[model samples]
Target: MLPHERSLVKRLQSQPFALIGINSDGDADKVKKILKDQDITWRQSIEGSTRGPWPTKWNVKSWPTIYVLDAQGVIRYKNVREKAMDEAIDTLLAEMKGAKK
Candidate 1:
């Protein structure tokens, strides 16, 4: 699996989070199928054209980008390249727990 894919799986298993991946080229269906086969529930949105969430909203420049958003739909982690995601999950959980306190 891709680093981002692995990171997503880890998050889904451990947190109250949702994974949404965008494919600007309109090929997200294949990725979705693969994830489904692995029993990974992910949501995907495809842009109408090459004009992705850029300059006006999210400013994404690459394909297979991952955005980890909080409950209020605000982006907390926007790493273009995927990482291990352990620290990120800890930080997000801490923030959520702090808010609840």
Candidate 2:
């Protein structure tokens, strides 16, 4: 995911796109090391230790949950990856482009 996400970030740098990560690892030191080792540069926030973690609030029960949203912030795709994820993003971008013209 690190490398693929990095490629995605680079590929879509000029587009209205962003990749946000919510890390749930309990070891802050390890997390920091992993980020540095993996060269993760996109926006990332450690999952809070509140009563309701982001996973609970967002109803996520697994790691690597992916959601693809459009400009309107609607969840147009869920759990998409690789070529499917790319297609979903491209379709949304094309739709946005067509709507403006």
Candidate 3:
């Protein structure tokens, strides 16, 4: 993720952002349901993580990673720790506000 991507993610988190999980491990269906259960809407990009567009293709290495992106399609946060969603959201929101001006 780039510096601008971080800023964009912070902005999105301040409002409403989507949690997209790109799994190349063929567990897309299972993970989709989990996110739904949490009332979080997500999309599974079946391109198998390692064979996608630039940047994503290079950085992705693990399964079940979360990427929070803004409406502009710029990644705000990637490889987010699922256990720290709350803190991440709070920090992202605050950062977004700080960078708004």
Question: Best candidate per TM-score, number?
Answer: 2
Q: Compute the lDDT of residue 44 as modeled in candidate 2.
A: 68
Between which residue pairs do clashes occur in model 3? 9-76, 24-48
Error of 3 at 3 (Å): 30
Model 1, span 40-98: residue lDDT tens: 55665655445756422666665545666676777777663445355675678688889
Estimate the overall C-alpha local distance difference test score of candidate 3.
0.55
Off by over 4 Å in 2: 27-30, 48-52
Task: Name the runs in model 3 displaced over 4 angstroms.
Answer: 1-14, 25-40, 48-56, 66-78, 98-101
Ranked candidates, highest TM-score first:
2, 1, 3
lDDT of 3 by residue, 35-68 (tens): 5664444355555336565337557566555665
Which pairs, if any, clash in model 1? Answer: none
lDDT of each: 0.61, 0.82, 0.55
Give per-residue CA lDDT, model 2, range 1-101, as digits (tens). 66788899899999988888877765567668778998887876677432237777898876778899999999999999988888999999999999999
Which segments of model 1 are wrong by more than 4 Å?
1-7, 27-40, 52-57, 80-84
| Residue-pair clashes per candidate | 0, 0, 2
TM-scores of the candidates in the order shown: 0.58, 0.86, 0.44
lDDT of 1 at 27: 56
